[model samples]
Target: MASSSKWTASDIPAQSGRIAIVTGANTGLGLATAKALAGHGAHVVLAVRDTEKGKRAADEITAEHPDATVTLQSLDLGSLRSVRAAAEALKAEFPRIDLLINNAGVMYPPKQTTEDGFELAFGTNHLGHFALTGLLLENLLPVPGSRVVTVSSVGHRIQAAIHFDDLQWERSYSRVGAYGQSKLANLLFTYELQRRLDAAETIAVAAHPGLSNTELMRHLHLPSAFNPLIGLVAQSPAMGALPTLRAATDPGVRGGQYYGPGGLGETRGYPKLVGSSSQSHDLDLARRLWTVSEELTGVTFPVG
Candidate 1:
């Protein structure tokens, strides 16, 4: 709770007996976040699309911390059916969940759609997590100090808008614009969810990794010329995962707060409480998006 400017994995308090579900835990920032949590004595479920990769990631975590409890749950965020199945399995297995980290996401990939026909970025990044959180929220509602930590991105400030008229981007699409929309939706979802949970023990918070060197950048398609510059400026997955770790584990974190890098432009540094774009704070927009998300995913929060 002290100045987060110096916050790191070492600052994470003991997480013994906690149950954490981290999406996309197979690699990059997700892997780092999961490993750190497990190392801190939390039982972590690596909810991923690839069982093989999840197993490997779990193995890696246990190898580093022999006492770590790591499990795998098959999840494909692009498909609503998959999300529901994963949520059901999780609910049946764990009566309580302390943390739900919506960490998995797709970046600037070529225009495509998910199994549910929503834009890949928007569907996987926003709608998928929206439904999953709603479905699993019941497990957390009764547990005091429970939290839902959503991973957003600095890109949310770039070319981002609700685009209600063309939410699917069927008429036209710009990969950057679509990605930004999804990240911005993340904040909207968190703020609105927090409002709904005002009287509950559960809380909603959001964080961004800044410019981290991770697989998410595979689709960035930045010219080879920028590789050197990017490599120099981008932080490691461990560092990038700090904001998320702080958001999820920091006792001082409050509902609706956003965390990001502490350096200039919030490009790279240690985790800190960061400000979001003005549009992301639009209460009306958040409410509207929440309604549309429920309609699209057919998953309603119990808080509502």
Candidate 2:
């Protein structure tokens, strides 16, 4: 891998003895990430809400790389019970984990609530990953070079702020605003988690897939007049998965760092180290959000 060259899925190093668990690996960025990792010899676990789709994805990976090792583990981040069950199942299967990718998330959807009663986007995107990471910390602690990579989004730049007053949007709700809040929380969580895990070999990092053409945009409706313009700019899911792959496998990557596209406005292109919004770096806010998250999820990290 060239230091200055554009990073691609091929840039991922060998993972002959490694194990990785990727959330929402049924399709989109998660599937791309899992396939790339498995192609390099890693035993990839697709932690998906739908077992049938997950198995199909595993089969696809195996079909591409006959030597690939993959498995399916059921995980529904929106519900705490499901998160706990998935963690226990993973703990029983693997004593050590090399990578845990929080790639599963819900985008702009009609106002709704998760099974846990939290706002759909915030509950599934941030809190779900938060609880899952804390619950699975033990499996990662003993594995040197292990990483927890959370997938945020460039949409986070739009009205992204932690609404401490109404964390669940009990009073009012906006699909776009809630999505932004969730993505922003991903960065704060990564930064704060990295701080808490400073003494450990494992690290926490964040990445965004840029504007990818994936099913995540199912709820994103635009006027017919703007559809073509958006299509002309959005990149394929494989291209969008670059930043995440880099964050997960790049040897030089540090804890708390963010990765995204290097092209204009970070809309598309190869993966590179990128800067996050100033709001995303607020330490005070990160700490407070971390505390609130712990209380809401009832899952505590061993690092702290």
Candidate 3:
């Protein structure tokens, strides 16, 4: 029994002839998002770091949808070299990208840096996607209804803000704070991108999967005593992926709009239009971050 009032994956419109690229599509919410789109008739390309896992994911999609068109492409978000290579491959293969879902990310992890010498969380979650989208912007510009959907999280509300002085967290770091900064960057990226794409047919949007059981939390550390309690409260990855699916497919969704769980505290439920923190909407901060991101990634967008 499906409730029309509640927007589920089934609510996604026909995606025939559409081409979607989902990052980190080898597992969890990314996999779920890829599956839904493939099921809806889109040609989905799983952009992942591990080609072996990516092939497995593509096989899984085809196993379920015999007629599905699924492909796997290598993408290591932690490295700018990989980002550029992946973008080149995608551009060579697909003339127009209908949906670019930046759904891959890292959560709380020990202090680390990407190959490009950026804080790991911010590098992969923000800068990586930033570079990818910019490099692929030319392909998306000609396609009507094309979108860039960046997946954020409720964690963005936690001690989050761009620390320009220490963008890489080189001075000091708290895993939680760094993770929140990355998530906040996701929204700021979206808002700034949308503003730049205002006159273009393409748009940029953001989404957050509430606390869902996913491998993305592998870095989370808690006392053994609390593991069971946390598991009991977490939502399924399928439900967690709804906001992303909605943000990607909803007809009424406007550029810069955000989607998330509709339940209390936005922990878990069906997807719906949601609001972000005031800090996430700070135009000055977004602009500055965008500029810094361009300089760091060496990728300039088609938009002004």
Q: What is the C-alpha lDDT of each candidate?
A: 0.96, 0.94, 0.94
After superposition, the stretches of candidate 2 with alpha carbons farther than 4 Å from their true spots are none
Per-model TM values vs. the true structure: 0.99, 0.98, 0.98
Which lDDT tens digits does candidate 1 get at residues 179-298?
999999999999999999998999999999999999999998889999999999999999999999999998999999999999968989999999999999999999999999999999
Candidate 3, residue 292: Cα displacement in angstroms equals 0.6
Off by over 4 Å in 1: 1-3
Q: In terms of lDDT, which candidate is strongest?
A: 1
Q: Model 3: per-residue lDDT, tens digit, 50-77? A: 9999999999999999999999999999
Ranking by TM-score: 1, 2, 3
Candidate 3 wrong stretches, greater than 4 Å: 1-5
Lowest-sum lDDT 10-residue window in model 3: 1-10
**True lDDT of residue 171, candidate 1:** 95
Q: List the residue pairs that clash in candidate 2.
A: none
> Residue 132 of model 2: what lDDT?
96
Angstrom error at residue 37, model 2: 0.4
